[model samples]
Target chain A: MVNANITNKMRNLRDAYSSALIELGSKNEDVVVLDADLSLSTKTKRFGTVFPDRFFDMGIAEANMMGVAAGLAACGKIVFASTFAVFATGRSYDAIRQSIAYPELNVKIVATHAGISVGGDGASHQMLEDIALMRALPNMTVIAPADATEMEDVVPAIAEHSGPCYVRIGRADAPIIFETHGEFKIGRGLVLRDGSDVAIIATGTMTAEALKAYDLLKKEGIEACIVHMPTIKPIDKKLARKVAGKTGRIITCEEHTIIGGLGDAVSMAIAEKPVPMRRIGVNDVFGESGEARQLMEKYGLTAENMAKVAKEMIKKY
Target chain B: MHDKALIKDLKRKALEIRKWVIESVYRAGSGHPGGSLSIADVMACLYFHEMRHNPKDPKWPDRDRLVLSKGHAAPALYAALALAGYFPVEELKNLRKIGHFLQGHPCMKKVPGVDMSTGSLGHGLSVAVGMALAGKLDGKDYRVFVILGDGEVQEGQIWEAANSASHYKLDNIIAILDRNGLQIDGPTEEIMHVEPIAWRWQAFGWDVIEIDGHDIEEILDTFHEIKMNEKPTIIIANTIKGKGVSFMEGTLSFHGKPPSEEQYKKAMSELEQEERELNG
Candidate 1:
């Protein structure tokens, strides 16, 4: 049931991450967790409380935390290292690259407070390039879950899948989209709605916005297809081509920079058979301090912007 | 006290390790001879005497782990592994060759007996801490050993790892700081001062043990003394860069440069003379 106070049943993705972590810790004795002094914000403290011995607080040192995660994973422990996305990817990039990705160790880097949606923290705290940074590395599986339910499914999926992985979650509560539990795969896309006019491919919190856009387009007599892509690296090429062929126009939505996020990934995937597309995301610029909702609107990440872009693209192309 | 025969055997092993370091670097045409030669004695001690490892089963769960933090000294590590029977001694000649398993840096996936892959400086100790932490959690007696270059200590991640190792009370970690005094550009003091090195480790809550890294007996005794340590221990091994090789000893030029053909032959002959003396 959707909560009355929240519009369209919003839930914190971090809560889902921690609950899933606790569940994982219960099942596997080798499951270990590390945090870089952001245990409270990342909600890994829940897992820490339940399994004190398995949890490690590395104390404001992200590089050391990543390396420690790699070490634990080296000794056959399924390790998850958590921190804000900015520090997790930027501050500890080399550590993750050398210790985890190069060796192909089983360390899941779950970074919270990703994208401009980390409201009031401004550009410094916002991690708009994490997907770009992680996806560029070899043997890194990058995933940005759409909502709380998807985030819940993603934990076990990444844990089950071997080798290094990067999962990005946002700070603000996101609207819950997926109702029923479904088996989540690493490099697959979910088709929420199907139509003929145009396709809306979205990742992370932007998927919920795409859903809203679908309704808005329907009111304007513009039928739209919605595809939720959680995994960025090893993207679902088959689904991307199918949607590209089905609809001549596509719109990619994300809360990250338009440079190397979902938009670039989709374009690369469908480059063989070109399609007229629009990327609805933060342009190649830094974000300023503002409310998460207001930033989304100002940065053209709202459903209204998506609908407008889709209509314009259809008419122009 | 170690018996005379055992000490003699370890000394012979250390000499053989040094020979392998020179031979590998000579064949590779480019490798870190200075650092590798400096750590040869410690490597011999680790693979031959101290570590509880079975070369036949390198991935043995209970086996002690070693992380070569100053990975440029990979020639020394490969030589030690070869002598310990992890791989064929002939493979040492292929160091850094195209498609060779003996890479410019140590890769755990490619090589046997390598606990953690390290190349970029300041990364290995953190991984060692993790391994030590895992040992503590699993209640395994296996210790995690890391060898850090004095120059490598300039990386801030080393201190971060040192702090966590002490904060977590990981007594199972035994770090050997190869204070060989010379880095690539110049001496570490002139480059980046990591002096009061033992005091630095002590301040970080480690039980610091300073010794001549080349002294096989002192190295063995320090290992023995730390057997009952309740805190993480750092053995600040004062060593000479380019040790054993007459032309290269304590010289900055040989840090990452391979010896010339004549230099290689002369170095081998000197090591052979030492071997003959030791046998006599």
Candidate 2:
């Protein structure tokens, strides 16, 4: 029993991103967009059409694009650099680290096609380690929205933020988790369901999976709460601690490397105030080319896998 | 901004920057003084004479920006910044101290006036190109200057940035090479030759100029010529490594070695006389 009364016409994360761009482009004249040959992919073609002068096609040069974004920020322009997560994080990590993070400039690095869901493009195009790279930087605010609806709010919030920020989104159409009208804030966790048996901490496409697991566990007479954590850097310590207090067992899930990512972040946050936890992510291995759905299932990143992990953890609880 | 007065003032500052390079490194007991002293004159002309910027508002939209691509020569840039009213000149003595804004290499967060933090070599020019391209897109008439060492150009990334600057037609970006001919190792020509340099830049679609990097008059005139030209400029400023210091000038051993207390005194006396003549 899911709530059938709630509208299914809610926007996906990509739609939210385009809608926010149109809104922000209208409000702020200083807001500029740069694409690493992927405006159509990231859905920033709307901004390109509306503000033609402000949009730049850097073209397969992610490092130069990042450096340009930093320069624009330094020169009093609000810059949103859009590209695939692979190039935005992997190809230009050093540039972002030195130019943007080291200087603490206000550049929004908006990355689409994140996680293993990027799929058949294969492991080369897939960016499974972006979260870890961006979060490790000193002045970067790392974000991976749970759904398209949440992406709409996160984009503008990152624009208002006066430091380096990285926002990751997926390419494939997933369930619209948010109602599209709920209030959103960066650096704050959004609690989707309330329970006490076990806690599932999730981000990006996996948030929807976590919700599915919550429903399955409830039917099986297990109470598991779901927390969609979008902003990974300034993590929601209050929400994390509160959930850990109510339910002593926790499971962290993401579509990233097991090391230096959401799992590591949550584990360290709880270590300060001890808690028992298990991590759900790529098991410290590289991804290969495959269907996004198949890859997610193969890597044990599905609702079934989450439910299984929760059941195993409940015995400990 | 008369050429005569500009040259007179910039020459005075250049002498003092060279002196500070020797003195600060001597105080630290170890630091790169040769390259720092080598580029003092070029840095002086760029800051006090060539580059258009406001010390009051460093981020002024129309203000010209400069990036020290060869960050090891930060002593010279830091000295020039102090004289340009970025911060108190007294902060120069606090170099490398923990919690001090001034680090061995320029850190943009820690320092007030550093445009980009450029410790790792072969990185700053791409950033400068980006700034210049931003200016073009914004319709702002700001020029960007980046200074590279003779040896630093040996990096493959430098060529990548150069290719990119030309490909994008980033004419607003001017790259000045301090052809001091010496790097941390012996002469750059001996270690790795980067000569036929002007042809290389010209091939890359730049308006190239060669000047005696030490001659204040030539340096000032070349910059003026560059501002009028629509193409990007590269001034290959030929300079002596440990310029103005008697025993250290043009020598490879002094590239990173600081002088002893006695040598520091000798270098100071020589620079003091040069400063007087420059001011007069």
Candidate 3:
């Protein structure tokens, strides 16, 4: 029932991020890390331990930290600046847009604790609009990796790529769907399962839920196609067109707010070839203090909700 | 301080930059002339006299970087970049045109020799600190120079940057405050009161250097005497708003407004008169 015991097998994505950072540090001599006082939570302090001098804790100054990241990148250093998603995107979006994105500097904004998955700290600490805010910028590449294995590939891919990119990472212990690693490329979506009835496109931790929902839809005499889109900007439009041609009906799933995010991007991509589509995400509302799993259930972010929504999309179409 | 010939040459260059600021803003019909004219000498000193930058190799690694935090003063930077052969001086005429590289603010992607794109206030210093920090980490000898506005320092991020510069002991950075004493709304003191300015910087763990920003010799000497105390230094360059123009000086109207046709003629004549005096 929706992978209830998957939590026992799941590993923290932050741990994978830490290991990838260490590997990136060894490969690129100019790789540097900067954090705004949440190094422990974001887990960038692991990089600090290995490369003590290269890691800078900017002391709870997210805006200044972003500016400093831009400057360092201007000086020919590949900079990865990390903080909570709320502070990284919401508190310092202007700095990110002007200093980092405007110049198209080589700064990777890898923010953890995104979405309502940031439990107990409540709505004040969670971020639900980062993907929307970052994707709106002209030169920003937005990515939300699904799990620890996906983060391992994405961390190096963004670092080796020379441009501004915003990466959304999660805080909760979610299930690991992919046992085998796939080649990570920007703007390419992987079709994990093939079906003719409907398509369920998802990103971030929601991809796992989409997988669970796909199985449920299959058992209930409905065939579903699951597409995992990691990169939001430079979205896989060709894939959307191909999927729309295949299934003819679609349901988009994301942990972000429905407005101006993956849903809008998908809609814009398939505008030339219209198809019946339903966006599944947090409606216009804020989150509250609760357990991460409970919040996911309360926000209608479970496999049961997605399966119900998938059935509705099929019937409506 | 004794190099009169060099000072005269710099004064002449500063006068030329002032003329460019007036002409470009007047041509654009909508640009900041007050702050642009206020820090012309400092821009002149940096681009022509002090900075070890290569105009041909705009991305030279060892080049000393300058971040104009008071980015409304973009005309001064554009003029200096043009005068230094980074681009043709004729491009200066198209200050904010549709297809020109020179935008409303400094855009590093479009404009060469602009180290970082900056328009919003209080962000440049943090970038400068990062440049300095990267230099220190890499053992590079290049320095970072940032010019901030007296009014712009009221942004909270300025102090956050200040805390970082001091926390990391970024010695190869110098922050210059173009203290023109006036802002768009009113005098900075009457508006927000950034008084005891030198003391405030000192409290932030900076070695403060107060100077008459217009005097070329004083500016040159202050740069020469930046002691190596392993701390970031702030040079308060006391300047007059719209320095070279007679009618626009100390006038709040010229902060963001261009001179009108009649006012432009009068300002050009005033600048020409100053240029004649400098040549003598």
Candidate 4:
């Protein structure tokens, strides 16, 4: 169970993403934004309002929007395309794989409303396997920023990085966990707290909870180091190795399925290091209609759950 | 348009491209020779006559782009690109082979002259729309041409792309439908029935124009008269499934099959005769 006061610190990531895009648009004249008629929801309408000529509304056709983004990328434009994660990933995967990833085009697909935090939109809207699908592609840089401030940094990072990227964001508000001027790098992890008892490697919104869990674990005399992995594709293997060596025990966390996402990426890297690890995530199941806070409780995604899961894994090891 | 000598040369080139299509598919032991043979004449017109491109400078930003949406018919485009000096004509034999650039489907990254990578059905037109939109935004004079298989239009995404192209008023892009009326299963009409296909594009606000695809002069003249300053155009080219070789044309067998040794010999002989006739 959560303290209910965490919501006070939470801010909408979509609005942060919107401001980032406008900033990127001002700096780079070739930066273009596209939306599949969800600009209002996805917050790309900010960029559309500021740079009308550079912003294209694809009118709810996500697949076409993807191809158009690739085309703009092909023509040397840094394209930021947005929609819900479900439609951006599941609906137009072929376009992303073949047109964008295959060509290694400079298209930044910044999709919001990822994971069950999309809430009452139900099973169809909740995208749990997008990270797996996108990470499997050869050239796609898959990312899920922890909060609004992380998203602000991640947006320009992908724009500056010349290649196809899938930046997943949640609909629900999340606590800011990074500084405004913080230096963010792709394929690297940020250590929120240092400890030797265990490593809590988390991504997306789950990173915020993992930080809270770290505080709880510290109070219980279990020193768990928290590493916030923003970029999932180029999973920080060096960081994984360092953490595994230091702590020798690890628990991966995500707001996604345990299979082939942050869990799989971390496990595949830490496998060589051979640490005793247990992944805490949605145990390969679809989420149902519920409020974002209620879904987190029902799905065992709260800080209390993370601290509990960490204690059990420590006992087992 | 009245230069009979130029038309004669283009006809000979089409036949040559057709011969290479059969040779490459037969060598690879598997390819879609039916669809490849169908688009030879039109592809020849685009590559050698109508479009502005420089093979020596394939990455020229202003070069016209051609996306073969019906990418299973890659053997045809491969031959056309080779003939245009994009690559070696000898490399045609290595199509679909391990470590070969000439893949089973068109890959723009691997192939020299390919503007967009395409293989999945119904994606070419969208890419073409993207390229056309890019050209418009950048104020470039380059035109984007896309070829879609008759059956490929059955995909919902094609309609999605169609709606956007007209919505954006992409006057610099043109789509050609290889309306051969045949697919892997059987005739397109019997398979899924996408009839009134011309009117469908018209309904999408495209300038629909129907023409005989195999007529070189007609194809050339059609490109010369395109209204690229007004709206995106869709040329519904009525063509045979396999246009060149006698036994292959209009037959469903070659839709996805490479010729046997005997069939390959016969196909080559027929193409050789056509080449001689055009050379005269």
Candidate 5:
């Protein structure tokens, strides 16, 4: 179980991605970079600086960028398109569906600034429903890496994946959970902690919150397991069934709407194999303009809120 | 390459293709025969003479990419695919039937020659643009070709794609507007005015040209010109709906209607005589 009181957690988001992209670009000539005029924002400018020929500045055309990625994939090129989650998912849903997902093109739609944690930008820029939109499409593998370390693994893991994939990353600096490089496979869940009293299933930025909750529960002498489901679309049914069957009590957390996201993905996976589950998310409400940390705290996306839900689920079960 | 000989050969192929369109539509009890017949000559010129492709290897990486933006006109494309040896010519009868690859719209998974599955109008151009951009990125010399119905250009996405294509200076991409001047609703002008079509594409920074859609030699020559041009090209091929059939020509009623039995006989006779003259 995680310890909430643990301090001095190392945080690195932007630079970690910049290094990963630079490394990937150096090794694979087939790996091309596409930016929607947001090279600096998504930290892909590092790749742009290194490989100018392989990097394309599409000038804010996300739809065309997606189409171009699909085309490149058809011609045996691995394309990584980068932009804010809002524009990548909202502005180019049709292009992703018809061109990328329909043919199952090997295109990685890497969306940064995902969820309400993309604060100060307000509801317009912060995307909470991208997972739902992407999950609805067939052959679209959706993954929201836990932090910088996970993203380092995810970038290469998805590049080798042969079909359409969406990698959602947070804009804010976050904790490094994995001590060393771990095996981060596609369509598989990572078990952070093991227990039988309750199961805390979370994804993306919320994985840290669930881990924090685990420590809080242990203080109360209640044992809880934490499962970080990075790949939301594939849902990691193996782990979902295993954890749910073992604990029989579940609490889902995410920095997104409860309507359709990590919560919805987990619930759908265990719908038939039912459990006493509670979801902690935006609850179908729009986010407000504030600091990223303030928004996370306001929407119950913190350690205390997640712990409260976990405790409640334990009582219910 | 004379106009007379080119028209004679194009007319024969167009009529034969029209006959197949009617027969396939009649068998399926559904198809867009008017647009298919209208675009038959254009399709023939592209497949038989214009495009650099190999029938045996549909996945030839360096082959030119052809996207049917006016995807509803699949009967014409299907006929072209069949004639190009993608499948048996007899398989035309299986169009739109259950468990048949020859559906009302082209599906890449179902058929060998289809580049991309397209039924939703105005989406194919974006795919074609992607292919063109990819060719540039990969340093491949293969060109990208797309055919759009006049009615399909009305979609906002088409304009979006066009602007992007020109912005990228996709000289390898060439679009042919099937100016059959008719859609399922009726005359394109009557339903939605898309006049000054060439000007619109030209304004978007493409190299635009206008030509008779039924002219095979002109179609072939225009494609060559586009290949040599420095910008993306659009050839507005002016054509009549239901081009080869006498009663059906320039009529909207046959846009989706298959010819009746008696009408089919007349169409077959006209095509046979044209074939005889071409051979002679």
Candidate 6:
């Protein structure tokens, strides 16, 4: 069911987010978009163009932008606020927690430039712990779509789901994995490939890497089952347990830090019937100035690293 | 000039709101009374006279909205909400209690008529700006009233919101700054000097109005004055901290500390005497 030439077509996920937001604005007059001086980067400017009256540019204030989004949501507007993931999550965390999440407002915080893949900007630009910060808040639905196609579905899905949601996307173009018409739900996981030897659960851009790792492991006669988990807050617990029970060995991959991210979430989800698992992500350290691919390789967020980790886990336990 | 009869009625309502503020905080055993009492007159005027709202239909889409940015004054807001029939007056007694709708801060989800949930300072104005911007987008005439504490303006987000409100030309937002001149630790001037607040608002492109916060007539007149402004307006309502209660007035102790048994009796009797004087 996976695409054969996934890496041939690379598209920035923010493009899909922007187009989907435009579509959402056309369908619902109450849909409003706001950006805090990153409209060009986050791609919320497309929605602003289509629905000029419904769009708000909140200058450079991310905290006030979150509060304004909450206020608009309070007045029955399906609000989508965008900025870089670091500012959207860390800078305005209290505003999101107090105004949006606490009231359970229908505000979708769609942030771009997540993970260490925001290269050349160094650690300040790269957001490594947005998932941890967002998922910890109650009533916040956290999602990180794997590729552009999934992001297209994610935008409208979060718009229809009436509550506070945080959707993180990347700055760089990623491998095109899912079809354009693929379905997306807030808390469901998709099984991209079926195997019995080991289960590799991945999210965001790392899911594409996991697909490549599947072929890498296949060359070594190791059959791998790949799961694409977009939603991290109300995580796919049933899938986590089922894959853990079926495969006996599991590998979790993400572009975020190993701490309090997909790795921790999967660990807690499969803890009832625990198995030997390995987490493939950035170790607890800050990223440096380099190309995105080099940073991913340096941080060990690669298909080769995931395949190696799976092999190590299989041998050790 | 305002109608004497109407002014008297609003004064009575303000006194009633003050009584409820004292009773609710005294019942809860822990709540902010100083700021709550400071804004009683304005809250009474807004909920009863100035705003267009239906207590029965709290979710009425076209109704005016109010965000109590200085949300520690929940007792005051809860009192005004109850008196205006958003909920039963008896519910004010359950403020800050376990499993009660009247939370420690104003929560829009738990309580009806709470337009926005706010406990953290500096959040209310931005939310109100959003609401006002929505009103403009929908071409609705519904106004958003936000009550802010003078101390809360120290938050950077407040300035951000101020910039957005005027930048968008959100004429539908009317912010009432509860200039009680005091904060938790000490006076606002000594703590963080929010003086020359009128000039600050004017510089932010808001049509600034100075009025007596505790005076119902002046509060009504200020609301009327801003009814036709082409820009966002801020009413700098100069007020004594802990107004109406003689011993508590102008003191910083009763800001979050609930009245003792003796203090509670004195406060209630003082409000009762004021009510009697107003009737005469």
Listed models, DockQ each: 0.86, 0.58, 0.89, 0.71, 0.57, 0.89
- What is the iRMS for every candidate structure? 0.5, 1.8, 0.6, 1.0, 1.7, 0.6
List the candidates' TM-scores in order. 0.98, 0.94, 0.98, 0.97, 0.93, 0.98
Candidate 2 vs 6: which has more TM-score: 6
- Per-residue lDDT for A1-317 in model 2, tens only? 12211235544577778889989989998898988778888988878998888887776778877877877787778889999999999988888987889888889999988888888888888888999999999989999887667777788888888999999888888777666444568788877888999999998878888988988898999998888888899888888888998889899999998888898888878888867899999998888889888999999999999999999988865
Candidate 4 regions exceeding 4 Å error are: A1-8
Point out the worst 10-residue segment of candidate 3 chain B by lDDT: B1-10
Weakest ten-residue segment in model 4 chain B by summed lDDT = B271-280
Worst 10 residues of 3 chain A by lDDT: A1-10
Q: Is candidate 4 or candidate 6 better by TM-score?
A: 6
Error of model 4, residue A264, in angstroms? 0.8
Candidate 5 residue A109 Cα shift, in angstroms, is 0.7
- Highest-scoring model, lDDT: 1
Per-residue C-alpha lDDT of model 3 across residues B84-197, encoded as one tens digit per residue: 999998888999888888998999989999988899998999999889998998898888999999999899999999989999999899999999999888999899989899
Chain A TM per prediction = 0.97, 0.95, 0.97, 0.96, 0.96, 0.98
At residue B172, give the lDDT of candidate 5.
Answer: 90
Docking class of 3: high
Q: Is the docking of candidate 4 incorrect, acceptable, medium or high quality?
A: medium
lDDT of 5 by residue, A52-124 (tens): 8888877767887887777777777888998999999999998888788887888999988888888898999
Clash totals for all models, in order? 0, 2, 0, 0, 0, 0
lDDT of 3 by residue, A226-251 (tens): 88899999899999888988999988
The parts of candidate 6 lying over 4 Å away from their true place are A1-5
RMSD of 4: 2.4
Candidate 6 has an interface RMSD (Å) of 0.6
lDDT of each: 0.92, 0.84, 0.90, 0.89, 0.83, 0.91
Tens digits of lDDT, candidate 4, A94-179: 98988999989999999999998889989989999999899999999999988887788888898889899999999988886664
lDDT score of residue A267 within candidate 3: 93
Give model 3's DockQ, 2 decimals: 0.89
Tens digit of per-residue lDDT, candidate 6, span B1-280? 8889999998999899999999999999999999999999899899989999999999999999999999999998998899988999999999989988899999988999999999999999999999998888888999999999999999999999999999998899999999999999999999999878989889999999898888888888888878555689999999998999999899999999999999999999999999999998
**Predicted structure 3: lDDT:** 0.90
